[model samples]
Target: MSNNHLTREELQDYVQHVFGASYLITQSARIHGGAQKVIYKIDCTNGFTCMLYVWDISSNYFQEEILNEPTFHSSYGSELFSLNTRFLAQHGIRTPILYDLNNDRDRHSYDFALVEYVDGQKAEAYFQHKNHKDRDELFQRIRDMLSNMHGIQRNVYGNANDNSKKAGPCYQVQRLDAETALSYASKHMKDIRKNDKRLLEKLCELEAAIQPRDLYNFIHGELGPDHIWIDHAMQPCLIDIEGAGFFDLEHEHSFLEFRFGDFYHYLKNNDLDPERMTFYRFCHHLSLISGGLKLLHRQFPDQQFARGLAEYHARCVVQMLS
Candidate 1:
């Protein structure tokens, strides 16, 4: 394994030792996405096909200090992905079935999960080729799935679990009201925008306008296009759920609009509170800007493109706040 890249021989050894399988490895293809995780499609001679996800623990894509914050889920690695999959499954939501998890200290220190491979086009691409009626049906199906997920109520808000042992009601992050959530974002923003007093004051005004309330529900924290895969039967399957948790339901709509630009217009006809949605959108944009800056600072401080991207996200936050 060179710099966390697994070679064919190493993968075969893992299959033999961990899985107790002597089947010859046929093919392994890497799938690229966000920098935090590495994915591979592995096919074996034993007629087994699976996708392997390896969390890049060594990558400073997200600052170590921010990720290690006590309020967030600590196991935002392979273990959390598996747990989130199980959580969604309990709610009748389809996700990639996790086959096995390997976290051995000696062999491979990084977390890894082997999951059933679902062969189909990504939902975004699938929707683009479909007729209007079919696209509407797909959107309805997605809406129903989101409704089912949000239907599952939770008493507290925040990370689903901190550890991997016990499943339900195991250990949740403390409930967060609007004030508390905004305060946390403010802390991060201070570091990202050190001397930008004008921008900081605008952020404070946005935070003050938020009305504190207790609303907790299951939220697929990162419900972006790439994570939604459409199967051959045209059913939606959710993947890459490292950020899933129990949180404010409004945040879900915020994420949906942020990731899918058209969602904002679609949701305008729905029974959602416009002001609340706007507030959540502001919060989400601020979080992304702060988090992106921290990642750039830690990993690519001298890179101009990286700095530009961070500035772009910050501009989005400013627009939302306005």
Candidate 2:
């Protein structure tokens, strides 16, 4: 997740390779974080300035992205480019204006995608700066934007109630009943917390029902400080679009709780039905905890903090409501 180095010649070759040599005038700057690719700032002589993200990638990941791009896009896929596009537009999101792809060109090497650089500083940098006193205000702004996004009327995937798509619905999740989901995971998975199983039992007793196309429809899928930018006027914009697919809106509701260190205000902001929202929140937390356990079961898995604490927090929420 750190910058991998390439010589100026290599950069030039890459630019030329992606854009063709004659018209490609450029300077290179690096973007850093949990990002998997090399992001460079490229300036062309035609007054065209764009951002290039290259993945010196593994073939498996490369192929997956190429094949999955359409599915991602289809879940508000139209928002892939064009400034201020809807579906995921209007909510202060800024994503690379994807232009071209060099997908799966080389099997052993890497793949690259070209996009217009989002113009802004990382939102977290501004908010977390030692001297910045506006941290609370920035948080509120982000909260407002997310609340607005959740205001969308459509589901993330084409089918809001269909579970077959994996990333659809207000409660898609393959339309599994609580028992089946838990049984499948417990028998087939590992690295799970004991608390998750307990939480699921409580949730299943309540039998929360999901509604499609409700006011709280859209979900960010992933929401944390790492995936955003702030424009010149200090507007918040989301940069990472990889996890911007569909899911239960409860994901977004639980998202604020998961990252913001609190859940009360998030519930308040949406004018949420206290009883129903609380139930869904429990479901979301339990699901994430379950997911983390399954990931841990994988031979080589990425153990993330969010995933690790999911079960613990789910229990806390369950107790609060109970």
Candidate 3:
């Protein structure tokens, strides 16, 4: 929206007047991604450049103007972002550092936080541009990063559940049963219907017969190339922890495998066998497709998102049934 508006002197003055005189915003750089929140690139604290994440007020948001929670989800997202930075930093993981956080309910009802800007391009783009010739290094780095992240996740505040001990052939089956894919795919052709029923029944049977193990940790639920950023040095740093949550350790590597293949270029470099990699990839796609279906199925949900999910489900069913 009016990219010029972000750099306007008057608006900058208002923000400065409100945030106090400790730091000067040299320039305001707006990030794309409408609604939900407004993000900006600002110079903040101790001569370092950082970003400001802020919430935007919508006419119908905040629970129909009556039942909004005490704190906005963006507020929740930013605060959690700060904690995420803390967790990663404590473990020597390379990430954009958090400088400060502010939650203000005044004037349009907004919340904001400041964080260091990790200079780089999205990992997906970066890898392709470099031709990903160093495939082995990239795979090792990814594996090590997720493993380190999970090792620390073992100590976070929200990782309370233990679904690992139940890990068996049936665990995947049980998860597939709880998925919304059944309804979406069932309305399709003979092959899809047959596959869906067989999959669900197998999952239920697996859950009962398989004795699972506890693979505990808070996983970066959205583990994909898009959420990763590779710095000028070509090192990987994870981002977009909005979907982060406690999950099966097996699920930690799901997103990556879903978008890429199970016998992925990265895993092959790391020597992860095709059979094991396929399982990881399956669980990853299943969980995500499940979540997407649930959100899309919400009563009177976002039509745009629903249509997107519909296309995605069509692809997923084809992939699964095949």
Candidate 4:
């Protein structure tokens, strides 16, 4: 397969293949700010709409070094999304239905999939415009959804695709064991070492203090309000679900706290291990530093936005150290 980006005609052909011979794309709009892949909103001749997900290196923001890192699986691929859709649905969680997936290397250099178009606004935007009472009701539903999702526990932690039978051996070990957590902390620290030695040192101190965990919860590894869609009927629909897995619940909460900011209290679990939260919070910022720097290094379209993200996290790291 040749390394070529999908043109409008190619995309039209793809939609026709999925929607049938007479199908035509009346209009298509590319979605912006997708760091790992290109997405398009396609409008077909008969008012049929769908989403196009194209996974190609050309649209990725991570540098080769970060992309090649075994521990960094930011771009897990279409298979995971398809698997997680069924998994999430089995738990009564909502997600857009996937229509088709294409991995034929001879036809294209990248993997792509067609998904049901969700006619809705992002949960973040939806939350912003809601009245106080409505907002409270929404949060109540969100809390329930998250509680149910995280309630699904496993003895061993890994990707959702991992076989349960094979997880028995690692049941005794925490996914975020001190050695593993500290090693990742140190690697991420390198990106910020020149900016703040004090924060770097504090990261080591924090990592050394992490408490061991025994149980793992199913989690959306990188959940943010933006990753949730509020359907026209006002139900929350999860997206960007390729990273769904079983891990320390604190890892998921840490990401929610940052992404949801002040709004996190409505969804926070009262029983979280405080020590795990603290360590995870620190690691979360470190990962942001690594991600932001990687975006900048790769010359992401919005250099200022990427730089600002890194700077904000750098400050958060300092505040945590203090």
Model 4 clashes, total count = 0
lDDT of 4 at 9: 82
lDDT of 4 at 289: 61
RMSD to truth, every model: 5.5, 6.7, 6.8, 4.1
lDDT of each: 0.64, 0.51, 0.52, 0.74
How much is 180 displaced in model 1, in angstroms?
14
| Per-candidate clash tally | 0, 2, 12, 0
True lDDT of residue 32, candidate 4: 79
C-alpha TM-scores of all predictions: 0.77, 0.59, 0.64, 0.86
State which candidate has the highest TM-score.
Answer: 4
Stretch of 10 with least lDDT, candidate 3: 66-75
For 201-300, candidate 3 gives per-residue lDDT tens digits of: 5444434543444434656755667677777776888776644555455544545655555434563234333443344444444443544444445432
Poorly placed runs, candidate 3 (over 4 Å) = 1-29, 33-38, 43-49, 55-76, 130-139, 153-157, 160-210, 262-313
205 in model 4: Cα distance from truth in Å? 2.9
* Sort order, lDDT high to low: 4, 1, 3, 2
Q: Across residues 24-113, which tens digit of lDDT does each residue of candidate 1 receive?
A: 678888775455677888887888777878876675365364365654444357767877888888879989998777877566667776
Model 1 has an lDDT value of 0.64
- The residue pairs that clash in candidate 2, if any, are 73-77, 160-169
- Show model 4 residue runs off by greater than 4 Å: 1-4, 63-67, 164-197
